[model samples]
Target: MELQPLATFRVELAPVLHVGRTRWGDRRVIGIVGGSFSGPRLNGEVLPGGADWQVVHEDGSASIDTRYTLRTHDGALLYIQTQGVRHGPPEVMARLAAGEDVDPAEYYFRLFIRFETGSPDYAWLGRTLAVGTGRREPNAVVYDAFTLT
Candidate 1:
């Protein structure tokens, strides 16, 4: 016998709100707006590939601008509206604002995005977004970075 692949994917819809405090005096929280849809489109077309994420403040402020792209050409995509908050107030962002030295790790972070397929429904992949450890340059104007896979 041989194993077959999935044709479609679906995740139950539900609004989510989560929060947690880090060991280094940092606190994080998030609110999932809604489910997203991604299908075959263009390079910047966040579907049939991936999407973007923005880490914002509690008072409706936006942080670093993080984006996700498709590395492979498969019938896969991601879509969702999410907002987050970070506490403890690191100085890296402040330093970058002032003209001083700041380490990326000083404001490290992470996010887990799991993709699930139908029938034998299971997570196809999981992407984690961590500070300092990424491919592109980190945004200082905002609070933190994001990841997707």
Candidate 2:
């Protein structure tokens, strides 16, 4: 199968709310403030009230699970859920966890994305498998999402 570009979007984040370690290791939540996206067939604004729930393991790798929403320019709403992992050298991971701006290429961040929407115009999203490659910024994340074809 090949991958086709679906959309590229930026997720602006609020500060991380550290929930500390539990049975699952270190836990934290990052809030999604606002952002925008555009592509040939999909264009929208990422609505607020979304959050990334993260767990950091002893190896310094992190498991990322995020739930969010997107409102297309035309008013259609898409619910998005992504599961992924982020890992790298200890120093690089430390820098990222500290909210520092490190080159995304220095580490690995990828996600499996799923979309659900009631709008006929976007119904295709629910039937396809998608993936995303992401980069971490100081206060936001940028990702390019692609559908498997």
Top-lDDT structure, candidate number: 2
**Candidate 2: residue pairs that collide:** none
State the lDDT at 68 in candidate 2. 92
Tens digits of per-residue lDDT for model 2, 1-149: 99999899899999999999989989999999999988877998999988999999999998989999999999999999999999999999899878899998999999999999999999999999999999999999899999999
lDDT values of the candidates? Answer: 0.29, 0.93
What are the TM-scores, per candidate, against the unseen true structure? 0.30, 0.97
For model 2, what is the C-alpha lDDT against the true structure?
0.93
TM-score, structure 1 vs. true: 0.30
Per-residue lDDT of model 1, residues 1-149, tens digit only = 33222111121211212233333322322222222222222111222322233443543223433333322234444332322332224445455334455554555433233332331212333332222222112222222222332
Best by TM-score: 2
TM-score attained by model 2: 0.97
Write down the worst ten-residue block by lDDT for model 2. 35-44
Candidate 2 segments whose C-alpha is farther than 4 A from its true place: none
